[model samples]
Target chain A: MNLGSLLDFTYLSFIDACKHSLYPYLPKRRSIQSDRVHLEAAVSWLMKSIDKVDGNGSSKAYRILNGWMPPYPETSGYIIETLLNLQDHYGDGKFFQAASKIGDWEISIQLEHGGFVGREIGVLSRPVIFNTGMVLLGLNALFDRTREKRYLDAGIRAGQFLVECLDENGCFVRNLHDHLIHTYNVRAAWALIQLGLLSGSRDFIEAGRKNVEWSLGQQLENGYFLHNHFRKGQKALTHSIGYVMRGILEAYLLLGEKRYLDCLKKTADKFVAIYGIRRRLVSELDENWKEVSSHLCLTGYAQIALNLLKLFKITKEERYLNTALHLIDDVKLQQPLNRRSEYFGGIKGSFPVYGRYAPLQFPNWAAKFFIDALLLKIEVMRDYENSLIDKLSLGRQ
Target chain B: MQELAKHHEVFAVFGKKGIWDHLDTYLRRRNEIDVHRRHTLAPLLPASHNAHAFPGPVNTLRFLRRLGIPCYKVSHLNGAASVDLLKRLKPDYGIAAVDHMLLPAVIDCFPTLLNAHYGNLPQVKGRDATEWSILLHDHLNVCLHEIVERMDAGRIYLKENIAVDKGDDFEILRAKCQDAAKSLYLRFFERPEECKNLYESNEDGKNYYLMNWELKALAQKKVERR
Candidate 1:
C-alpha cells in the first residue's frame, strides 16, 4: 500500500480503537475493572513504543525516564501519565507525589523564554535541534496535564524558540551536512503542533503546517526523501522517513486539516511500499531483510515507525493499523524473551555494551522508547495492570 | 680523605628546564669557585654522556654519587649508555628521580638505592603523581621518600604537607612540591645522620589505585557531594 493509504488506515483504526476502549471507562460508567484494564494496557503500549529505541545510557528520552540527575520534560510526561493512571485506579497519592516531583524538576529547567537548554549531547557535550524539540514536546504534555500557567507559559516560550529556529521557508537548518532536512523538520513540526494545539496559538500551528508542506514538497518521485544535500541525492531510509511521517501526521492532527492528512498518508504509503509492511514488522531486521543485524541506529528507526503506526491508528487509518500490528507481531517474534518477559514490551535498539545488537540496555532514551511501546501496546490490548504487575514481578525475579 | 678524593667522585644530575636549569647554572658557578681554590670540581653535565641521547642512566648514576660517597663515573655512565651501566658503576648506593622503570632487585643489589617521589611517602606514590592528586582533590602533602624494595614504602627523608588552594592545578602544585624537595634535599644533605633518623614507619593501610572508570565514578561522586 502507498504511504498515504497506510497512514489513513492506521489513523482511523487508532481513533476507533481508542474511542472504543475509552467509551466504557467514561465517568458514571459501569464495568470499571474492564475500563481500567484497557486504559492501563493502552498506556503500557504507548510506553513500550518509545522504550525500544533507547541506546546505551544516553539520549534525551532515556534521561527523563531513568537518570539520577534532573529528569527531562519528555520523560516526565510519561511519568505523569503513569501516575495519573495509578491515581485514577488505586486512588493513591504516592503516584501523584512522584509525578509532582518530576513535574517540579521539569518546571525548574524551563528556560526563561520557555524551552530547555538542550542537554549536552552524549559525552561530547553539544546542543542540537532534535533534543530541543523533544524537550518542548515533553513540556507541552506537562502543561496539558497540570494546566499550570508556568508550564503553559514555558511551553509557549519553547514553542516560540522552536519557531525562531526555522528558516524563511519553515524548514529546519540543522544537520545540513547530512542533508537530513526532512528528519529534523518533522520533529520541529511535531513540537510546533503540540504548542499550537495546546496553547491555541495560530502562529505555532501555521509554523508546523508550513514545515509539513515544505517536507511534502521535498518528497521525491520515488517516495524517498532526499538525503545528503551536498551530493543532492535521494534514498529512502526508515529513520528519516519515519520522522517526516510523524511530523506530517502530527501537523494534520493539530490542525484537523484533510490536506495535511492526505499528504501524510501519501508519505506513509510510500514508506510502507519502499520498506514493505512485512519487512518493517521486525524490530531489528536488516536492510537486506536479514534478521541478524545488531546496530541501534536502524533499530531506533523501526521503533519510530511503530510509533508512526500508532499515530496512524489514532487518525483512523486501517492500512496503517494493520501495518502496525504486523510490525508489532514481527518485533514480538524477534524478541526471544517476549513470551515470558513483561519489561521488554517495547521496541529495542542495538546496545554495544550488552553484546546484543539493538540491545535493551539501561540508557535513558532506550528505556523511554521501551516504556512507550509497552504502554501503547497495553493500552490497545487492555492488559496494562497485569503487564505492569508482571513487569514488577519480573524485576524481583 | 685525600686518597678518597682521588678515588671517589660525586656528580649532580640536573634537567635543562625549570629550577633544575638554574641549579645547573649555579653548580657551574660552584665549579668555577672550586677551580679558583685549586680543587677539581666534578662534571656538571647531564647523566647522558652522548649529547644526542637521553641521559636517564647517567642521571641515575649522578644521583648515586650524591650520597656523600666517592665514586668514579663508569664507562657506560660516561656517555649515553644502556642498562649495562648498572654493572659498570657497581656503586655502594644508587638514587633515581623520575627514572622510567623501577630498578630490579638484582640492580638494587649493587647498591642501596633511593628515589625522590613527588607525593607523600605513604599516600600518593605512583606515576602521574600530581595529576592523581589534583583529581583526587587531596591536599598537597608531598614528600621525597627513599626508594627501596617496596616502591614508596622506602624511608622518608623529608615531607611537607602544603595546603592546596581551591584553584590550584597540577602544574602549580608540582612546582611547589619541587621547591619543597629542593629545600628538603639541602637540609637532608646538610646532616645525613639527622635526616636518616627522621624516617618514620610506613603503614600498609593506604591504597595504591590504578586509574579506571571506578576512579572516574568516585571523582564524580565527590563532585556531587560538594
Candidate 2:
C-alpha cells in the first residue's frame, strides 16, 4: 500500500477540482472554468443554507452555519488575501478595493464584547472561540493590508478574548455545549500562538503553550481520536484521519513542540499504512472519497508534510525532510493532467457532482490552505538557499 | 576730613567671580578716598558642593561673618533670612547689579538700596537692554538707574549712552552696561543728594518688559537684518 501515491492522487484530484471551479473567478488568462463553476456552486450551496433572519429574531441553524464561514468580521481579510495574490501576479487597484470592502465589513461587524458576533443577528449568540480565532486571522490580514492601528487593536482584542477564555489548566472551554471538549480548543490555541508571535504578548504565548499540552493529552495511542464529539463521531469515517491530522499539524506549527510534530508524524504514518499511498490515490476517484475531496483537507496534509520537512532541515534529520519532499512530489505528480478548468489549478473532487459529492469549488478555506502551502514552499526554498550558503562557508573553513 | 568721611564701613556684594570681581576691582580702584573699603563677594555654589554644611542660611551667615565687613556675603538668598540679614545690617545704602530679582519694599526703602540697570531711563527699561535697542534697530545710549519697587522706574542717578554693535549679545552689552554703571556710581557718590529725585512720579510712563526666547529670536532677526 503506497500511502504516498494515494495522497498524491488525492492531491491531484483536489487541485483539478479547485482549478476547474475557480477559473471563471480569476482573470481569463488564469481561468479554470470547471474550478470556477465548482467554487460558485459551493458558495451558492453555502448561501442557500444561510439563514436570512430578520434583525430582531434569533438566527436560524442556516445562519449559524453560514456565519461560521471565513470573512467572519465582515472585513475584507479574505478579499485582501485574494488581492495580495492577484497583486503579485498583476498590479491592479481593483483587487485592493475589493480587499478594502472586506476590511470595512469586518470593522462594521465588531461586537461590543471585543469579540465579533457569530451570526449577523441572534439573541442566543455568545462568543464562539472558533469564530473569534477566524476574526483574529482576518484582523491580522486587515492590519497587513492597511498598516492601521485600528486593525491591530481589533486583532489584539480577539487575541485577548482567546487568552481570557483559557481554563486554569490552559485549555479553552467550548461555550454553550453539553460537552466542553472540542477541536475549537486546538484552533483557539493556534490563534493564541499566532497572536503571541505577532504582538509579543507573554500571556498569549503561555495560553498557547497550555492548549498545545492539552491537545497532546487528547491523542490516542493509535494516533487517531476515539471520537471528536464536536464533529460528532465524524472521525469514525474515512475522512476522519485528515480532519484530526489537520488539528495536530496546526498545533505542531503553532507550538514548534517536538511532541506535537512527533504525534502528527506518527498519525500520518498510520494513515498511510492503513490506506496505502496507492489506495489513497484510487480513493480520490472512488465514490466514498467524495465527501473528503476538498483541496483544503488535502492542502492541510501537504502543509504538515512541508512544515515537517522544514523542521527536518533545521534538525538535519533526513527522515522528516524526505517524507515532506516525498509528499509534495507525489501530490504534484498525481495531479490530474487535463485539469485546466479546475478551481485549484487542477485539483478535483471538492464539490458534489450530480448531488453525489461536494462541489469542486474554490472554498475560502481551501484557498487559505492552498496559499499556506505555497508560502511554506517559498519559505523552504529560502531556507535551502541559506543552508547552501552555510554549507559552502563550512567547506571553505 | 575726606578720609574721616570715608571711615564709614563700605560693603560690596557680588556673585560669579570673573565678572562680579572685575566690577568690584574697578570700584575699589576708583574709591581711593575711602580709608576703610570692605568688599564681600560670595561665589555661587550648588548645594552638593557643600554637603557637610547646612548649605543654605547657615553657610550664608558664616560667609558673611568671615568677610569681617558689616555687609553680608549672602549666596542665593531667596528666603526669610535675607530680610533678617538686611534688618540686621542696617546699612546706609545697599546696591545690586547682575542680580535681577526685586528686593522687598522693606529692604528697598532702607535709606539707599540702589540697583544698576543697563538700559536708559524711559526706554529700553526691561531685559536685553542693548538687544532690545538693536531689535528696535535704534542707535541709543545705555544708562544706570537705581532699583526701585518698579525696577528701571527708579530715580536715575547717572546715565551714559554707549553705542552698541549690532552683533552684541546680552553678555557683551551687560559688561558695557556694568562698566558704565560703575562709573556712574562713582559720579553719583560725589553728589548723591542731587539725583535723589531724578525719576518721574508717574510709573505708567515707564517702560516695563521681559526678555524670553521669542524676544531673543526677534533680536537675532534684527542682527540678521543689519
Candidate 3:
C-alpha cells in the first residue's frame, strides 16, 4: 500500500524468485510430520490469532510490516466452527468458550439489516453479502452446539440477509467483490444451505440451490470458473477455485443429488488430472486452466484438500484421497513451528511469504482451512482404521 | 499355469525386470534369498515358482517357456509398445500375476484384466494388505477380481477367507493365502463367464498405503505370537 511496503515486497519477491529458480536444482528438503502434530500446532495458531484481537473474534492476519491487522468479522465468523470443532476433538472447554465469545461478538456487530460489515472491523461500515453468509456459518454452528435462541436468531437474520441479496436468477447482485459477480460466493450458498438445514426453511434451501445452479453456469467446459478472481480479468487463484469447489460439494452433501457431484466433477476431475502430473498446483490458473503463477497459495491448498477429502468420502475414489493427502501434507510442511514468534503455528498465505496473494502475511483463514482439512483427514483415517480393524476381527481364532 | 495352457491358449506377459527382481536374482545366486537362508533347510523353503517373494521375472519366464507357453516382456504396461502388443494379442482376458497398476491403455486391450489380491475385497486394499489383515482383522483372505484403473478396486470374482490358525506365522499365512489365491484364479479361468461379476464392485473399500515400519513390526509380532 505504501512506497516502503512496495520496496519491501519487491526485495522479498526478488529473493523468492531466486529460490524458485533454484528449487528444482536443490536437493528436496521436505519434512512431513504426523497429521496429529500438525493439527495441534494449527489449532494453537488459531487460538493465538483469536487472542491477538481485543475482545473476541480473530485478527485478519499477522502482517510483516504491521504487527496484526484489525479483527476480521468474515473469517472470525467462520472460525467459530473451527474452534467448536477443536473443542469436540480435544475435549477442551476453552475452545467452546472462545467460539462462543466470537459468536457473541459477531452478533453484536451485525448491522440493523442483519448483514455483517465488509472487510476488517473499522475499515468499512457497509454490510456485504459474502461477509453476512460467512458470519451465518459461525452463528448457525454455535446455535447447533448451544441451542441458544440468540445465536439461532442471529443465524436466521444472517441467512435472511443472504436470501435477500440473491436476485431472481440466483446471483448476488449486491455487494459483489469489485462490483463483479464471483463464483466463490457459492460458499455463501453453502452457508445458506447449512442455515436452511438448521432452521428447516424451504426458502433458504431453494435459494441456495438456485445460486449453485447459477454458479454452475459460470463454469467453463474446461472446469475453470469465470469471474472467480478477486479483481475482474485476473487469473483465478487456487483459493477462490477451492471456494467454488467446496460450495458445490457442500450442496451435494445436503441435497444428496447426483447433479451437484456432477457439477463438482467438472472442476475436481480436471484438477486431479493436473495435480497427478505436476504434483503441485500453481497459485493462479487462467480460464483455460493453464498455470499462470509459480507461487503456492497455501490457503487454497488447505481448502482444496478439505474439498477433495469430502469428494473421496462420497465417491470412494482413491485419487481424490491421495491428492487431498498430498495437498494437506504440503500445507503441513509450510506451517511454522517457532513458538516464540507471533506467526508460530500459523500457515502463511503463500509458500514464499511474499507471493502475490496476501503478500508478507499469515492469514487466519489459511490456518482455519488448514485445521479443517486436518480434522477431515483424521476422520478419514479413523474410518480407514475402523474398517480395517473390523475386517481383522473376523480372523480372530 | 501348465494346466491352464492345456485348456486355454495361456501365455505370460511380464513387466520388465524391476530393481527388486534384479536384487532377488542376485541374492538367489549367492544363496542369500532369505534372512534364514543359511540356517533353514532348503527343503523347508518354498519353490522358486511360489509367491513367497520376488522369484524374478527370469525364473517365471523360464518356467513359462518350459511349459511351452509364449512369453512377452515390456518396460511398462502403459507404454506404447506394450499397448501395441496387447492390441495384436487380442486376448479374451488377461491375468495379472504381479501387483502392477495397468493403465486404461493396457486395460482396454482386453475385455477383462483379472488380478488376485492377498486381502478381502471392499475391505483391505493397497500395499501390505496381508499384514494389515492379520493385525487389524486377525484374518487372512485372498480375492480374485477384475483390475480397473484404480488399484485393488474392481468387481470381485471370488473371495476366500483363509483361517488363521494359532500356530501360523507370516510365512505360513502367506503360503495359505497364495495357495487360496492360486486356486481361485484357476477356478475363475475354468469358468471365466460364470466368474465374471461374481462379486459386487468394491466401492466401499479405501486404498490403504504401505504400512509404516512401526506398524509392520507390530503386525509381524502379532502374526508370530498367533
Candidate 4:
C-alpha cells in the first residue's frame, strides 16, 4: 500500500471499530429462517420509510436500526421507476401517485448541468456520473409511463451529461469524484440504454453498448468483474457486485448479445457453486472469491437470484430455478413479518443487521431491487407457464 | 475447478494431513481427512477416529459424484500407489486446489501440473501469502503458473493484481485471493496456450512464511484502522 491507501484503510477501520463500540446492542443480522414471502409488506416498509422523510421533499433512506435519513436525490429518482412498475404490475394507482410525487421531487433537484447532486439533502454536492445516470433511469421510466414532457426533458439533460463523460474506451472516465472507476456503472449503462431507446438517441445507445463492452474486459475467469470499488479500493460489497451482474444481464436483455448472456451464466454459476442450492451468501469476498464476511447482503442475494430466475426462464435449467427459488425463500424468511418497527418489510444492507454495506441502514435501492426481483419472479414464472400453454394450444390447433 | 472438470476427465488426489487452524474445531472423526489424528478435543467435542474432509471438499465431491466423477482418498498424494493410480487414469491435466500442496513427486507425477498460487511469484512465494502481501504492502495477485522444481518459482501462465482494500482482514483478503486464483485458473484453461509466453523465471525470488499471530493482529489492526 502507498502512503495514501495506507492512511485511507487505517481511517476506515478506525471508524468501523468505533461504530461497533457505539452500537453494542445492535443486532448482528436479521434472521431469515422462515419461508414466507413478504412482497406487499416489503413495499409498504419502503413507502413508509419514504413517507417518514422529515423536513424534506423525500426520505433519502431508512436505517434498519434507526429512523429515516434526509432525502437522497439519487435513490429518490430511481425509486420512481420501482413505484411505477409496482403500479403497472399490480394495477394499483396508489403506486403511480407515490411514484409521481417522487418523480416531481427528483425533477425539482436537477442541477444546471442536468445532473443531480450526491449524498443526502443538506450538502452542497456536485454532479456524479453514477448518480446522474440513475436519476436518468427514473426520469426515462416516468416519461414512458406518463409521457410527461418535464421528465423527458430532465432525462435528456442527464443523458447529455453522461454522453459528455464518455471516453474512447466506452467507460465514463470522468466526474467520478475520485480516482476509482466502478463496474457498477453497468447498471448506469443499462439506464442509458433505456434512455437512448426511449429518446431515440443513437449516441446514447452506442455509449451504453461501449460501456458494457469495456466492462467485459473487467471480468475475471472465476466469474467476477473488477473495478467494484465503492469508497475504499480493492474490496467490494456483494450488493454492488450484484448490481453490476444484473446490469450486464440487463444489457444482454436490451442488446441481444450471446457474450453478455454467456458471461452472466458463468458468473451466476460461480455463485451457485458457493451457495450450493441456496445456502447462506456472505456480504464480502476477497480477491480469491472466498467468503470475506459472514453477514449477507440481502439485496445482492435477491438481485442475483432474480438473474438466475431470468436465465432459468430462457434455458429451463432446474439448477438455476432451484437455486433462485431457495435463495428467495431465504430472503422472504428474513423479511420482518411481524416487527412493529418501520423495518417491518425492508431488506437490509447486511444480514445480521450490521455488516458493512449499509451498516444497519436500509437504502431505498435495496428495497427497489428487492421489489424488482420479486415482481420479476412472478412475471418470468407466468411467462414460462404461458409459453407452455401456448405450445399446447398450437399443438391442438 | 468444475469448469475445468466439465471440459475434461478430472480426478482428485487427497493428502492425509488436515490443517485446522482452530484447535477447537479439529475433527475427531477420521472419515474426512485422509489421515486420522489421534488427538481429540474430547468431552466438549467427541472422540471418533473417522474424519471427513472439510465441508467444501466433501460437498464438492458429492456434487461431482452426482456428475459421475469418482474421487479417491489416499494417505499420500505423491506416494507410489497414488502415482500408479494417476498413471493408470492417464489423465491429460491436473488442477491442484487451494488446501493441498503438491510434492515434487506428486507434481511431477503428471506430464503437466497447473497450480493456482495465491501470491504473484518473483515478488511473493509460499504459504500464508495474503498476510505477507499486506505486511509488505505489495499489490496482491492471484496467479496460474506451470509447476517447476521450486515452489511458486514456476512458469507464470497468467496473473491478476487484486486490491487489498480498506477494512479487509485475514479472511477477507484470503477469500479474494482464493476467488482470483479460481478465476485465473479457469481462464488459463480456456486457451492453455495463450499463457505460454507469459512465463518469468524467479529461481532466487524470496519466499514468505505464515506471519506470527501477534504480527497478524497488528497488521490487521493497521488495515482495519479507521
Candidate 5:
C-alpha cells in the first residue's frame, strides 16, 4: 500500500471504531437511493467505460491517479449481456449498437487458434482458456439475438479452442491462469455449455460437462473448491468464488443436471449460513471457510448477489433472494453519488477504494456486475409483486 | 433468567469478555458523551420511562447466579470449549440472549436454535432495525425465527406487530420489542410445536444499516405523531 492508501486505511479504521460510540457527532453519509436511479447511473458509467476504449470494448478500469486504463477483452466479452439487457429494459437502440460493436471488436481480436488473450489488449501472450470462453459468451449471445453466421462461427472456434485446452480429465491444463488448473474454469465451462446449446453441438456440451465434473471433484466436503485463486496456495477472493459459483449455476440451468443444482445449493447454503451468522463477509476466505482477508471485495459482492438471484430463480427460495438483496444493498452503499467526479457511478474495486482487491481502481467488471445485479434485482422484485397481485386477484374469485 | 427458569431449565452463556485498554475506555466514554449529547429527545417522554439497561456479562451472570441458575462464560462461543460445554449439557434447544453470530460448530450442537429479531424480517434486517422499520415502513415488529447461519434470513415462526402508539420514543419502542420477544420465548417453551408455522418472507426486503440522527429524529417524530 502507498502512503495515501496507508493514510486512507488508518482513517477508515478510525471512523469504523468511532462510528458506534460517536454515532451522533459524525458526518452523515447518504443512504442508498432507489434501484432504478443506481441502475441508470451505473449504466451511464459503463457507457463511459466503453467510450474510453473508443467504443470498441470496455476499459479494464478507471484509476484515480491515472486516467482510463486499456481495454480488457476478458471483461468486455461478457459485458455484452449487460448492454443487451439494458437495451431490452430501456428500449434503447444505442445499447444494442454498443453490444454489437463490443461483440465485433472481440471477434476482431480473436487469435488464429480461436482463443482470446488474457489481460488488457496489446499484451503479447498465448490465447487463454478463460478469456476465450468469456468472449464466446458474448458471441453466443449475439448469435442468439441476431443469428449472424460470423458470431456463431467465432463462438464455435472459441469453444473448440477451450476443448483443445481441456485434458482427458476434463480440466483445462493449457492456457490456464498461472498455468495451473482453476476450479473457476467452470465459468469457462458455462460459456462453452452456452455455445453448445446455441449451436446444437454435442461435443461442446460434452466438453463443458467434463470440465464441470472435474471441477466438482475439487470441492471439499464443506462446499469450498480448492485451487480457486489466481495463484495456488493463496486464499480465494470472493471474485473467483463468485465466478466458480455462477458457472456451476449456469451449467445446472443449461444441462438440466440434478447433481449440479444439488452441489450449488450445498455451497450456496453454506455461504448463506456464514453470511447470515456474521452479518458480514470478508473478501478472501480459506478452504476452511475462515476469513483470510478483512477487506471488502465490492466486485465479489455484486457477482455473488447476481449468483444468489439466479439461485433464487431456480429454487424459488426466499433465503437466497433475501441474501442477494442484502448483498446488493451493501454494494449500493459503496457507490458514490458525486456526479461531478470522473469516477462517479462506477463501483470501486474495494471498499474505501484502497483495500487489497484491485486497489485504487474502479474495475470495469465491477461496474458490469453491479449493473447486472441491479437489473436482476428489479426483475425479481417485479415478478414477486406481480405474483402477489395475481394471488390477490385469485382470492377475489 | 428468573422468568425463563419458571418454565424451563435456564442457563447463561455470555460472549467472550474483552480486556479494556486505554483506547477502549476512551472510546466507551466518548460514546457515552455522544449519546448524552443526543438527549434532546429524552425529555420528550416521562421521567419514569427509563429504557432497558444492558448490564454487562459479569453483572448478568451475578444476577442469574443469585437466582440459582447456572451461568457459564466462554472466550468464544464457537470455540471448542464452548462446543464441549454444549456437548456435555446436550440441551434440547439453545436460545441466543444477545446478538452474537454463532458458527456452525456451535449451532450444530442444538437440534433447534432460536432468536428473536427486533424487526419484521425479510424487510428490516441488520443494525438499527427497529428505528429503520419506524422510519421506512412507519411500524415496528418482532420476528421469532430459527437461528440460521444467514444473518436474519431464517425461517420465521412468529411475527408480533408492536403498536407504535403516540408518545412512544425510540427507547419505548425498543422496550416494547424486548417485551414481545420475552412473550414469544415463553410461548415457544410452553408449546414449541405451535412455533412450527413457517411464515414465508421470501421477498427481497431492504437490509437497513445504521440510521443517521437526522433520519432517527425523523423516525422519532413519526413515532410521536403516530
Candidate 6:
C-alpha cells in the first residue's frame, strides 16, 4: 500500500473513532426494531413499489418520503422473481400480471446484443454482465410462469451472450460493470447454469461450472471471497457477499455438487461465527471476516438468512435455523407498518435510512430480496414444523 | 449421560466449529504468526487430514441431537448463540467442555458453568495444560472447575489426582487426563442435589500456550529416561 493509501486508512480510522465516541450521545431515530413484517405489509410494499416505477418499468424509489425516481433495471429484474414466487405461493393472478409486466419491461430494454444495461434511462446503455444476468433470471422465471416463447427466447439469447463472454476458465471476462472483476458474478453464472438446465444446453452448464470452479479458487481459507467488490482492497458490502453466497448455494442445489455445498457450509459457518446469535448484522465486512461497518444491509441480512435456512433444510442443524430465525425476525422488524406513505412496506438500503450503498433511499432490490427471505422463512418453518409433527405421529404409531 | 438423563433432562449440547475447521484455523494462524515477519510459520500439515476421513465433531453432535439433546453449532465456546440457546433451554446446570475459551457472557450467564480441566488446578490452568503438567511432572490432577472470565480461574468444583504411570509418554498422559475428566464428571453428577456452585476462588495459576517443540522433545526424553 502507498503512503497516500495508508494515510487514507488512518484518517478513516480516526473518523470512525470519533463516530463511536459520539454515537452514544446522539438520539437514535427511525429504529428498525419497530415491528415484524406481516405477509400483507410485505406484499403491499411490493405492489406499491412496482406502481411507483417510472416509464422504464422498474420500481422507483419513493424519494424524500414522497415522489418516485428513475426505475432501476438491476433491481427491477429481481423484483420480478420475487413477484412470480409470491404469485405461486399465494396463487394470486395480480402478482403474476405484475411480474409479467416487469419481465416484459426488462425484455424490452435488453440490448440488441442480448445483454442488459446497469441504468436503463440515464447511462450510455452499454452491456453489463451482472445486469444482463439479473434480467435473464427474470425472463427465465417469466417463461416458467407464462410458458411464453418470447420470454424463453430472450432468456436463451441472454444466456448465449454470457456464454460468449466466458473466457477459457469460465469467467465473464467481458462486460463487467467496471474494469474490476467481481467475485459475486457467481449469481450471473448461476443464472446461466439455470438457463443451461432449462434449455438443455450442455455448453451453457459447462460455462457456469467453470465460472464456479474459478470462484472456488478465489475463496479465502476462512471462507471469505477475494476481489468481491468494485474496490480492489476494501470492505465488501453484504450485498455483494450475499450475491456470491446465494449463487454458490443455488449452484449446489442445482448440481448437487458436494464440493460446492462444502464451500457454502464453510462460508456460512464464518458468518455464524461473526454475527453470533441474534446480534445485529452489519452492512460490510473486511477480508478477515470481521465487520468493518456497523450499518445494517437489509438485503444482505435477508439474503444470508435465506441461505442459512436452506442449509438448515439440507444439514438439519438446529444452529442454522436458530440464527436464521433471528435474522428473519430482525429484517421483518425493519418493514414499515401502518403508514400512509409508499415507504411503508419497502425495505431500505440501510437500517438507519442513512448509510453507504443508496443512502437514505429505498432501493427496489432491497424489497425484492426482503420478499424472497420472508417467503423462504415461511416455507422453511412450515417444513420444519411438519417434520416435528411427523416424528410425533411416528412415535405414537 | 444415561444417569443424568434419568435425573434431569440434558436439554442441550453445544459444539464449536467442527474439528476439521479447528485444524484448518490452527494451521492458518500458525502460518500467520511467525518468528520472522514473513508469514512462514506454516507447518507441514498431514495431507490426509479431512472432515470426511475424521468425522469426530459432526458424529458426536449428531448422536447428541439424536438423543433428544439440542446440539448447537457455535462459533466458539462463548459464542452468543450458545448463550441464547442455553437461555432457551434453561437447564439446571450449564457444562462447558468445548476447546474455545469461554466468553464473559457465557461465564456470567449461568453463574455456575461447570467445566472439567484435564490438569491440576492453580498449576495447569490454560492451554495444553496436560502436556505441560506431564512435562513439569506436576501432580496429574484432573480438577473440575467453573469456567470464568480468566481461563480456568473459576472456583473449583472437585479435584482428584491420578498417579502418572512410569512409562507415561505424551499420548499416555493425554489418555490418563481424559479418563480422569470423564471419571470426575461421573462422580460429581452422581448426586445432582449435592453438587452446588461453591463460589470459592483459587490461587492464581500460570497460563500455558503452545508448547515449544524442543521442550516437548525434552519432556519425551525425560519420560523415556525415567
DockQ of each: 0.00, 0.00, 0.05, 0.02, 0.09, 0.02
Question: Which ranges in model 5 have alpha carbons more than 4 Å from their true place?
Answer: A1-30, A389-397, B1-96, B101-226
Q: Candidate 3 recovers what fraction of true contacts?
A: 0.00
Q: In candidate 3, how many Å is residue A362 off? A: 0.6
Docking class for model 2 is incorrect
Docking quality of model 3: it rates as incorrect
Q: Judged by TM-score relative to the true structure, which candidate is superior, 1 or 6?
A: 6
Candidate 2 residues A314-364, lDDT tens each? 455433443454344333332333433222233222321111122332234
Over the stretch A217-268, how does candidate 3's per-residue lDDT look in tens digits?
A: 9988888898889886688999999989988898988888798898898788
Which scores greater on TM-score, model 3 or model 6? 3
Candidate 6 wrongly placed segments (more than 4 Å): A1-37, A54-56, B1-226
Q: For model 1, how does the per-residue alpha-carbon lDDT over A1-397 read when each residue is reduced to its tens digit?
A: 4565345335434543453343222222121223234334433433343333231111232221232233334444434545555556558675555555555665665656554544432232233455556656656666776787876776677677777767888777742323345443566677778888788888988887777777777765544454312123333334445556666666766667787666666556644443341233222333333343333333444456455556655664333433444344333322223323333222334322222332322334434443344445545534322443454456556
- lDDT of candidate 4 over B1-226, digit per residue (tens): 4676688677676545345422322332121121222122122121231131112224555677777777886656767887787777776667776443566766766666877777656676766566656545436777777776666787777878877667765655555666677778778777777676666666665544434333355456546542
- Cα RMSD of all models vs. native, in order, equals 27.7, 32.8, 7.8, 17.2, 8.2, 19.6
Candidate 6, residues A125-220, lDDT tens digits: the string is 688888888888888778877789998899988988888888888777898877778889898889888888888889888888999999998898
Worst 10 residues of 4 chain A by lDDT: A22-31
Residue B18 miss distance in model 5 (angstroms): 12
User: Model 1's CAPRI class?
Assistant: incorrect
Collision count of model 1? 90
A14-120: candidate 4 lDDT, tens digit per residue: 55456334322222224343222467877888778677873123575665334677888777777887888888777988788888887788888888888877677
Worst 10 residues of 2 chain A by lDDT: A56-65
Model 2 agreement with the true structure over B40-66: per-residue lDDT tens digits: 111222344335221223344345546
Clashes of each: 90, 64, 7, 38, 4, 0
Error of 5 at A197 (Å): 1.6
